[model samples]
Target: METRSLGEHERSTSQSPRVIALANRAGAPAGHVVLSAERISKSFAGVRALQSVDFDLRHGEVHALMGENGAGKSTLMKILAGVHASYEGTIEVDGTQAAFTGVRDAEEAGVAIIHQELNLVPELSVADNIFLGREPLIAGVLLDRRRMVRAAERLLERLGVAIDPESRVAGLRVGEQQLVEIAKALSLRARILIMDEPTSALSASECETLFKIVRQLAIDGVAIIYTSHRIEEVLDLADRVTVLRDGKRVVTAPIGELSHGAIISAMVGRELAASDRGAAVQDGAVVLSVRNLTLDTLGPHGWRRTLHGVSLELKRGEILGIGGLLGSGRTEILESIFGVQRGWRGGSIVVNGETADIRSPVDAYRLGLALVSEDRKERGLHLYESIGDNIALPSIGALSQFGLRAFARERALARGMVRQLAVRCTGIGQQAASLSGGNQQKVVIGKWLATEPRILLLDEPTRGIDVGAKQEIYKLIFDLAAQGLGIIVVTSEMPELLLLSDRILVMCEGRQTGLLRRENATEETVMRFAAPGMAAWPHGTAS
Candidate 1:
């Protein structure tokens, strides 16, 4: 690894200045003002979720909202969407005071929100979903399916999305499904659109399409509220940016006025530590192996293969990195290994030189396996339960013997793991839902640690956590790897993959496209393998 001098760091710091300016006026006093939120504050069960945040939206502008998880971005957006009716604030829409009592009310007021986790019924067809609650009816009672299909087709055509309007949504890929969600919102005749991490599940090309749609919406005078953790996307797409930190509005400015470094510094209140791009392990024993793994795609026996004879080896004391654009089946690999996908066929899993039959989570758990799933809230924790219960849930069987619950044993185990994992909580009995985003993640890690898994599957483990918490998790991962535990990490962050992996595997369109040893791996090589258009892995140094 190369090192830079303090002089260079100082010089880089002083290369930019702070300023902000609005742009591309559409209407309204030459300012394009559409909506303004003044002194908005909200609390949940006595906990302040947002505190006196002032925000603005303009016609024909894509305004980006940014903050770490639990930093008030979602709370503010929810208020705008009328999910929280009791928030204290004054919202003026086109210089008229407005208030909403429900999501329906917000939609009636020309507001629409597309959440990170899509709200769609897979059993329904794309056309039905687009016209979902407010379907165009022939009469007051009878439905109009043909008109709905035609409308859906037109919507997709406008966005340049190629997909059957009558196709079952369940069979679509994540990216295509996201487009359908947008179409549903557009059907609402929205003047103000709130998009939360819209491109998170999109491939590079899919992202480009979404960007074009956003641009088109802006050109049509739509006021857009865009939020994402991907900084590069904000730089490319946003007209103006508003940042929130610790439930307070830190700054609101035009995109061109803020450099990438300045945005990072403002969001984090400090510079990002220069990421170390190197291996976190040495060559070690091969602990996990797969041969000819395949999964039939989802549908009524849809035979579109999501995984195709994929094979890989993960060594003990190594962080095996899985790299791919979203929807490329990188997540499926982990799910298959953890027994989440039972439709997998023609695969042999060898762990520590022994053939493993992992048909269910029980089978995987008994073999000392742990999985931190991609959607942490959906797959990792029981939100209504206490932190103690969640951390010891996997090992609860041990706490109950002969049909008797061992309360003392459970408490003792939870306490031990909490200390070991450095989990922050008001108390062991505190609700898991009460903890902050970073602490909730720690509890998830603690749950797996209690089982003492020999193999660990981590999917976007550090996403949305604060910088301090991320550093702690990295240290914990390093400690576990040092103890010879086999760790497989699936991450979207290219820098994270470069820094943590001993060996990297790049997947594209359900295929293991290429492999790189520690000495051979670089950002360029991994990206080339992961990108769909690259014919072969290119040899080069990292940028």
Candidate 2:
């Protein structure tokens, strides 16, 4: 698969002349080497992060760097971008030896990196953040706010995104914040670009826009180092891929030379079996039902209705998937049902056939409902806190005896959850930040599971985790469903939703457009109803 098969995007833009130009740096031919790292070895507190890793990028190439979490992918990328200055290695830029002392040095050398974790200041406007330290000056004195905002708008337009330049980043959603981050990177106009899991927070529609941008950049001869867990997209976009496993480069070849199995095998050092979607369990009684779920928010333009009479049902032991592009009210539906979404205008929630007036998370929790938020670092976990402390947060009251805390009970419960989830850690006392992406996600899920909820709501259940951990979590969901826990999963990945869902509920603009049986759920069918104006799904049903 290649960008040609991604379909033609009509967007076309001319770069700003006043903004930093992104010409062919080093005056090299299209296929000439632009950047290289030889025998790069790094360590952290005595642990070897990378073992003599070697990688190279060309003038007009989309090189994909791949590996599981903590497999030395980030370490090598950080070394290249000058984030890790203490690494032992030789870096060459444009056939000349170069040592970057810091990120500014790398940027000055025509290199810019977009980290997987967002690095924007929430207090600043989108335009301010885009040109943070390099804000243009009027006559080299006054801040050129007009030029900065215009340039930012052009960058957003080039990416086909509709974010306002004046809007503060704090008010934006995770996906929107990610778009801002990309815009910030593009504003640099660097010849060498590195993107780490750029699409982890983007929606299907936004991803299309980004793919178009990437394709255009490649045609313009900008070298890009793209990293992603979504192998399918990599197969479509990258010209070559370099697989790193446990800190060493296993293979570097043209994308066409390797199959999906080959990539997975190289990453984990084993052939992984495809996930089997076993037969759906026998029907269980309805556990949750929502009717006329309406929500409104006080935006700049007064009150805007985000949810429009969305309705759904979850039965015991069944996994119901909510599928949609970003801002389609997928997360809002979950939050509203969990009594977290703001300004609930009208809605009726029925749990176990009883009408419930749930207004807060505590009320929902009391009724045996738990929500695992999409962002683990910010909302789900205390990164600096110990694993045992995090898992025992919600259940502290229940684990206590009178006014005194039951330390032994907390440790016992944490140990049980850790063993059940297979979280690899030194001990329960280890800080959550010390764990890998997969282990951190497990802790988030485990903490919510400790609440012992009958209904579970998971948003982006496997976002930013590796393939191995994804498989384990998939199996765990099935196992939990089999034990009669009703689950609702909100995911942007089509294949994941299809695999884990017993029935798929498609949403568009906050409206429930289609309800598909597991057998009827395909990528094409789901998109038919999920995308607005894909011709109305006449046969679509809510029942």
Each prediction's Cα lDDT score? 0.81, 0.85
Q: What does candidate 1's lDDT look like per residue over 265-363, in tens digits?
A: 778777777544345554567889999888886656576788888888888888888998887888899989988864646689998889999888888
Candidate 1 deviant stretches above 4 angstroms: 1-31, 275-283, 289-311, 325-329, 344-348, 353-357, 419-439, 463-472, 509-511, 531-543
Candidate 1 global lDDT: 0.81
* Residues 1-543, model 2: lDDT tens digits: 012211232233253311112222212233778999999999887888899988999876788999988888988888899888888879999999989989988888888898888899999999999999999999899999999999999989866678999999999877778778777777776778899998987767668777877867776567899999999988878878899988999998877677888989988899887675577664769999999888998877889899888878899999999998878889999888888857745889999899988889999999999999999988899999999999998999888998788999999999999999999887999999978888999999999899899999999989999898899899889988988999999998898999999899898887778899888889998988888864333357634
Worst ten in a row by lDDT for model 1: 17-26
Best by TM-score: 2
Superposed model 2: Cα runs more than 4 Å off: 1-30, 125-127, 136-189, 533-539
Per-model TM against the reference = 0.84, 0.87
Number of backbone-clashing residue pairs for each candidate, in the order shown: 0, 0
Candidate 2, run of 10 with poorest lDDT: 17-26
